[model samples]
Target chain A: MKVRVTVMLKEGVLDPQGKAIGHALHTLGFPGVEAVRVGKIIDLDLKSTDAQAARAEAEKMASELLANLVIEDFTVEVLG
Target chain B: MKVRVTVMLKEGVLDPQGKAIGHALHTLGFPGVEAVRVGKIIDLDLKSTDAQAARAEAEKMASELLANLVIEDFTVEVLG
Candidate 1:
């Protein structure tokens, strides 16, 4: 099975790296590029046979090591 | 308009950051987590009224500012 996890900073969280990227875009003449929020995408290949178990395991992975739950939120997508 | 740009390390490229994260996952007891490849997702709000133009512009943004073309690839998705 394949899974994709996206981890993003929650709203109202300060993202200095994202701000830097947004500034870079403006300097590169990308007009109307108001803001840029940068997040993470984690692609995984798992051997689990059950889809629900895989998702639950992946969610546990996300909460445990993949994301900073205090300031970030994550979503998981399972793919065949 | 809302757009999402995902930038990922190209195949065969060495991703030390991703490897470190994978190791961390293993140490945290995430069994069967074979590998973890980390990428970036950029969310943007644009003022463009045309969908095609917005996608093209966002692609340009990804190429010019969001992704390192030498070792990375990017995809753009437009959302209402």
Candidate 2:
């Protein structure tokens, strides 16, 4: 099974990198961009065949190593 | 409008970060993880209201600045 884990900073947490990207975009003539938030997309190729099991395993991976629980939230999706 | 741009390295490109993450996962007991690829997910808050126009603008941003055409491929999605 294939799993995708998207890890994003929690709302209210400051994202300096995102701000920098937004600033760069504005400098490059994209004035309509109001805000930007950047996150990580991790795709995992798992040996599991079951979607349910894959999702569970991916969630574990996200919580354990992919995301910081204090400032980040992650969503795990199984693409079997 | 809300736009999501997912930028991923082109196939066959070296991804040391992803490999490191995979190795770390393996070390941390995720033996079922066969492979890992990492990408970026960028969320943009745009002033545009039209979904069609937002998609076009986001695609333009991805091509112009968000992704390296020589090494990365990006997908743009507008969330109206």
Candidate 3:
């Protein structure tokens, strides 16, 4: 199975990297951009074939190591 | 309008960060993981109302600034 985990900073947290990217975009002539937020996408290839079990395992991985609970939130999705 | 740009290292490229993550997961007891790839997800809030225009703008941004074309590939998705 293939699984994906997305980890993002919680709202109300400042994201300097995102701010810098938005600024760079404006400098590069993309004036239509209003805001930007950056996050992590982890794609996993798992030996398990069951989608439900894979999702649960991915979620556990996120909670235990992939995310900082105080500042970040994560979501797990199972893909074929 | 909102747009998401996902940037990933091209296949065959070395990804030390991803390797480190996979090693850590293995040490943490996720023995079922076969491989892992890390990428970026950039969420953009655009002032434009037209989805088509927004997607085009985002693609331009991704090509010019968000992705390192020599090593990274990117995909742009427009969302409401």
Candidate 4:
């Protein structure tokens, strides 16, 4: 099974990289863009054939090693 | 308008980060995981109200600034 993990900074946390991206967009003549938030995606191919098992295992990887649960939120999408 | 851009490295490209993450996961006793590919997500809040216009604008930002056309492929997902 293939699992896709998307992680983003939690709300209320300031993202300096996002602010820089917004500034860069404006400088590049795309002033219509208001804000930008950058996040991460991790795609994993699991050995398990079960969808539920793969998602549960991927979620474990995400929470333990893939994402910072303190300030980042992650969603595991099973793309089997 | 809200637009999401998911960027991933082109196929066959080396992913050291992904490999490192995979190693860490196995080290943490998750040997069931096979392979991992790491990508990026860029969320943009545009001033435009039109979904089509927002997607077009977000695509431009992605190709011009958010993604490198040489080694990365990006998809724009427009969310109202």
Q: Which stretches of candidate 4 lie over 4 Å from their true place?
A: none
lDDT of 4 by residue, B13-70 (tens): 8999999988988899999879999999999999999999999999988999899999
List ranges where model 1 is wrong by over 4 Å.
none
Give the distance in Å from residue B61's predicted Cα in candidate 4 to where it truly belongs: 0.8
Q: What TM-score does prediction 3 earn?
A: 0.98
The DockQ-based CAPRI class assigned to model 1 is high
Q: Give every collision pair in model 3.
A: none
Model 1 accuracy (lDDT, Cα): 0.87
Judging by lDDT, tell me the better candidate of 1 and 2: 2
A1-80: candidate 4 lDDT, tens digit per residue: 99999999999889999999999999989999898899999999999999999999989888988899999999999999
* Lowest lDDT block of 10, candidate 4 chain B: B24-33
Give the least accurate 10-residue stretch of model 2 chain B, judged by summed lDDT.
B71-80
Each model's TM-score for chain A is: 0.94, 0.98, 0.96, 0.97
lDDT of 1 by residue, A16-70 (tens): 8888877887787887777778899998777787788888888989888788999
Model 3 ranges with Cα > 4 A deviation: none
Query: Residue B65 in candidate 3 has what lDDT?
Result: 87
For model 4 the local lDDT of residue B16 reads: 97
- Cα lDDT of model 3 by residue, B1-80, tens digit: 99999999999999899999999999999999999999999999999999999999999999988999999999999988
DockQ of 2: 0.95
Could you report the DockQ of all the candidates, in the order they appear? 0.81, 0.95, 0.95, 0.94
lDDT of each: 0.87, 0.95, 0.94, 0.94
